[model samples]
Target chain A: MIGRFVARRAAMLVATALVASVAVYGALFIAPGDPATLLIGGGKPPSPQLLAEIHRQYHLDDPFLQGYLRWLGGMLHGDAGQSLTYKDSVTHLVTERIGNTAFLVAYAAVLIIVPGVTLGTVAALRGGFGDTLVTVVTTALMAVPTFVMSVVLIWWLSVQWDWLPAYGAGEGFTGRLEHLTLPALALATAWLAYVAQVTRSAVRAELASEHVETAWARGVPERFVVRKHVLRNAAGPLFSVSGVAVAGLIAGCSIVEQAFGINGIGALLVQSAAKQDLAVVQALALITVVVFVVVNTLVDVVTAALDHRVSLEGTA
Target chain B: MTGSPPLLVVDDLRVDLPTRDGMRRVIHRADLTVPAGTAVALVGESGSGKSMTARAVLRLLPSRARTTGSVRFDGSEVTTLGAAGLRRLRAHDVAMVFQDPRAHINPVRTVGDFLTEALITTRGVRPRAAEAKVTALLREVGIADASRRMRQRPPELSGGLLQRVMITAALAGEPRLLIADEPTTALDVTTQAEVMAIIDEARAERGLAMLFITHDLALAAAVCDRIAVMYAGGVVEELPARHLHERAAHPYTRALLASRPDPAATAEPLRAVPGRPLSAFETGPGCAFAPRCAHAQDLCHTERPSLSPAGEGLAACHFPAADARVTPQPGARSTPHGR
Candidate 1:
């Protein structure tokens, strides 16, 4: 049963990634300006002979369908063409900066998971004032946009306190972690609130569920009841919601990376798009799509694995 | 009940619930006893506090509800037990089977995990040993293929199977008292009969005392040695099971017996109980069932009659169906406030 579930999820991931890659590649064709400019980076005006040589070399004269198929075939073979702005290899540029985005996502995920889940659990287990306090705090956190949060965090933590660096990716693990803290927190704000609210509701619902009451009556100690029964039951929602919060960091990471002056892929995409660098934009778009598809698939798989009802009976 | 002393004694229990309206007494008064190795049925209509009284045995009432009562198990007061005491009671001395087995077992967990949890956690029984013991208990409850069922989740099994798992889990701790609260309510007729038979056979085999809660009078009579009929938050009558059909003294008990369909007399109309059942909070100053009682008089409306000896057992009525009536039992008294 587990084998089948994994097989199905893997198939879905592959199919979704393929569709997203096609869409990303097609976006390059639909872009404004010359096709030859896309192929040759347009840094200098091209002669007719040079244009013809480029067109023939790239099969630009072929029909749109053939061209797309050729491009897709080339992408599969690790030939993603060149950026119109930097005129650099798209794979090299993307691979170089994706690591930073991955690190930032990990940092922000740490921020989101720890406090988000704790506050939610506190709200659920200790009601009345604790519930109201969590509600108010999470509401305030979510109400602020990520960029605004970024600016404010920088102003306070960097300028006022002078405790951390304001911009630029720092060297080494410790330095980078130190420099990334404020940006990571800024990126984590809205998503942290999202995870917290989801956790709160999930815990509340699980607490009222009959099985949990049964656990209590069975004299399973309070801690085990909360751990094995309550939190374990709530884990399904937490997995999927936390996955979305992290995978959705693309948008937040873009703004935070720019505000922090970090050399990350999200910021690079924005810069590339502004310069009409179709290759870099397409690559980053495909990467974003792949990240969402993979992360969501992994979340669902984990959820199914954790829950027998979901795995054997399929999700309800 | 013969030769064995009472294992559980619940006397003059009252529970007050906080609702949207106000604080209402849900369990006005509940009194019953289960001698060691005997089964007692708490029979009642909906909202009569049958389940509430059962829950009170373990302090499992809602958070805001106020309760004052005496619940003793094996000569120890259950209500006053500390946390560790209560845990010991629930884990080792008493175990419960709920109405809907599907709802009571965690859906995500395997049947084995649930069955072995108390054994592992409370008894300090090793996991492998617990599994072996649980498997034996499962077969004892009539589940033949225990291992396969253990690995399966709750949703994968039928209601009867899940209920058998509940019974297995209940017996896992080898508790002296088993509280079966409408254990077969959610099953189909065939499954209900099977589950009840399993419970009856298992309880008898283990010499375990049971408090069976159900609405079915005949079922109660069949599985329980004694039947305590509840009416609107109070036990209106308590009598030996065999005497239930013949010597029922309370008007409500007689009415309930008459309400059952007589299969042999196909042409006769079914005798439905008059008026809808009243909830715990909705009772009046008089007897809770007095408004719908055919034998009710002016005095009956003025005050409530407490449980008094009548015939083989006890009945709470100003005018019982048996010859003893008009002159109330000597020690039986009424308070100004009926509740």
Candidate 2:
């Protein structure tokens, strides 16, 4: 049963990517941006002959369907055409920058899920005073937007305290990790509060459920009941909520990247979009769509695995 | 009520819960006893504290609730038992089956997990061995394809099937006593009979003592050897099952007996008590049922009555019904110890 279920999910993942890729490519194609004009210098008016030569070189005069087909075929292989301004392979540019974004997102994911779930569980388990404290702190944190959090964190942790570097992706593993810490924290601030609140409500609901009561009444020890019954039952919601937060992170934190001077994919997308670098934009957009679809698809599978009822409903 | 030693005794149990008005009592006074290998039914309407009394046996009360009475199981006080002792009692000596089996079970888990979790975790039985044990117990509870049912989750099973699974879990502990809290209240009439039959047969085969809680007095009298009728958190009467209809001493007990529609006499109008049932906190110093009692005199309105020997049972009424002999209906079903 599990094998068949996973097979269906795999099919869904591929189908979702196929549909989204087409939409992103088509939308970007129709969007107002001329690559040939972008490639020629904007400082001086170029002759018509030079413009036509550039258009033919990039196949800008080709029909939309033919151009899309060519682009799709090239993407199937290890090619994404060439950048308009940088005159480099779009694929190589994306690959070089994707790693930094991936690291930043992973760092932010931990900052969001770990502390969020821990505080949420504490709030649920310890009612009265402690619960209100966690709630108040998270609520206040949530009110601060990501850019403001970035500014405040830099002001307090980096600038005033002189505790950590305020900019750049840094060098090597430890150095990069240390420098990325502040950016990840800023990016995770609002979402951490969101996940924490969601987890608190979910855990509290599970605790009040009859199943947890049954486990307690059966003489299951407290630790076992909390781990096996309460948390295990609450796992589906946690996975889903965190999955969304992390998947959104994969699209890239442009604001954080800009604030911290990190040359990640978010910065690349913003820079490329400003210059009308359609090739890089198209590639990154495709990757973002795939990442989002894949993350949510994974969430569905894990959720169905944790909860049999969901799997049944999914198949039904 | 029997010569056998009492397996469980609850004496003058009172549970107070926190409320906006202050500490309000939910269980005013409840006393019950279940002899070894005998079934005793605590029957009452909704909000009668029958379920609360059953829950107190396992020390399963709200964290903020305060209690004033003692619960003894196998001659040891359960009310004051330490954490370890409570765990030991719940694990080996007693187990409870809840009202809604679906709501009480982890829906994500297979029946096997629900059944063998305690055995593997607390009892230290090997996983494979626990699985085999619960599988056998499942078969005993009338689940023919025990192995297949074990792999299935709760939502896949019908109400009757899930109740059988609950019975298996309850019996898996091999406890001396089982507390069934309205085990069949959520099922339809036909399924109710089947589920009750499974519990009855399982209890008989294991020779387990049972404290059955239900609002159906007829089913209680049929299945249990003794009956304890509760009113507004207090057990108002205790009597042998055979005397539930004709020899019941308390007016509240008689009123319940009358309130049940007589199926054979369809031409007669249905009977209902005069006042709505009161919760434990709603009662005053006087008898909780006084406003609805036909025999409520000035004295009955002023002071509450304690359990005193009346007719063939113990009653908590100032005026125990003495005219039962004149009102004996030959249509009353003769229910002996259901074997």
Candidate 3:
């Protein structure tokens, strides 16, 4: 069953990636203005012969569909073509910045999931004042946009207190961590609220389930009941919600990256888009789509495995 | 049965639950005793407080419920037991089998894990030893291939098989008092009899006392030695199971017995007691069953009757049916009422 599910998901991933590549490629065609004009000189009108040569070099003179097909063929062979603005291979540019974005996302995920799930569990178990406080605080936090949070955090920590750097990806391991802290926090704020709300409802529902009641009736200790029954059963729903949170975090990172001046793929995408770097934009958009699809598929598989009632075959 | 000390003694147990309106009394002055190595069934309709009375024995009422009473198990005061004391009492002395086996057993966990969890966690038994004991108990409950079933989850098993597994888990603790709360309600008729037989055999082999709760008086009579009939949250009649049909001293018990549909007597339709069973909020200062009782009089509405000795057991009726002068009303014969 597991092997079949994995095979099916692999097929789905490839199909989705192909479709995403086509859609991203189409965006470049529909976008106004010519990349060759921006590449040669932004405002100056170059000689006609020089412009024609530049268009030929970048394959801009070919039909849009033909150019896209050629790009797709090259991508299938592990080549993403060259960036118009960076004057480097698209793969090389993405690979260089992907690690920074990954680190930032991983840091934010840990910060959001750990405390969010823990406090949510605590709030569910100890309901009166603690539950009310968590609900009120998380609701307020969810209302604040991520970019607004970034600006407020930057002003408070950097401009007012001079505690951490407001912008730039710092050097070395410790320095990089110190630099990512502010950006990660800004990105995690909204996600933390989402994860906590989901966790709270799931834990509360599990606690009231008849199985937990049976555990208590069997004289099992309170701690064991929570660990073995409540948390284990609640894990399936939590995984599903966390998958959505991860996708949202990826999208939110671009805005946060621009705010903090971190040279991650998000920052790269913003810069390339402004410069009309079609090759880089198409590559990054496809990567984002692929990541979202893969994460969602993994979450569904794990949820089905954890909950016996959910059939993987039925989903397929 | 009369000479031995009772295994469980519940006296004047009253449970009041706080609702949106006010504090509503659910169980009022309920008294019962299950002697060592015997079975007692608390029989009643739904909302009659049979399950609540059983849950009160374990102090497992909902958070908003307030209970005031004495529940004694083997000379220990269950009502006053501390958290550690209650835990020890629950682990070593008593265990409960619920109605729906599927709903009660954790779905993600295997049958073996569900059965041996209490033994390993509460009794400090080794895992290997607990596994062996669980397998043996499963066999004792008539489940085949115990080892294979242990590895499978609850959803893979039938309702009857899961119920038998629930019994095994309950008996795994070697409890002195087994509270089976409508354990067969969710099963089919054949499975019900099989489950009840398994419970009876296990109880007899271990010499355990049981408090069985059910709405079917006939099923209760077949398995239990004594029957305690509950009405409007109070024990209206207590008698030997054999005496329930012929020598019943309470009008409600007589009405209940008459309501059962006997296969042999198809000439007459099943009789159901008149009027809806009163809820906790609906009962008054008078006898709660007065509105539905055929023998109800002006005095029956003025004063509430308390349980008093009639013949071999107790009945709480002003005009006890055991009196030779009072014959059953002619029209009160087998007429079906609402369930």
Task: List DockQ, one per candidate, in order.
Answer: 0.71, 0.72, 0.79
Ranking by lDDT: 2, 3, 1
Clashing pairs in 3: none
Compose the digit string of candidate 2's lDDT tens values, residues B1-339: 456458999999999989899998889999898999999999999999999999899988888989888898988999899999988898899999999999999998899999999888779999999999999988887889999999998999998899888888988888999999999998888899888888898888889999999999999999999999999999999988987777887888988888889899999999898889999999988999999998788878778888877766688888787644326654344322100
- Candidate 2 lDDT tens digits, A138-172: 99998998889999999999989999888999888
* Chain A TM-score, cand. 1: 0.92
Q: Order the candidates by DockQ, highest first — what do you get?
A: 3, 2, 1
TM-score, prediction 2: 0.94
Please provide TM-scores computed only on chain A for all of the candidate models, following their numbering. 0.92, 0.96, 0.95
lDDT for residue B28 in candidate 1, whole number 0-100:
92
lDDT by residue for model 1 (B164-209), tens: 9998888888899999999988999889999998888888889999
Docking class of 1: medium
- Worst-scoring 10-residue span by lDDT in model 1 chain A: A34-43
- Give the clashing pairs for model 1: none
Lowest summed lDDT window (length 10), candidate 2 chain B = B330-339
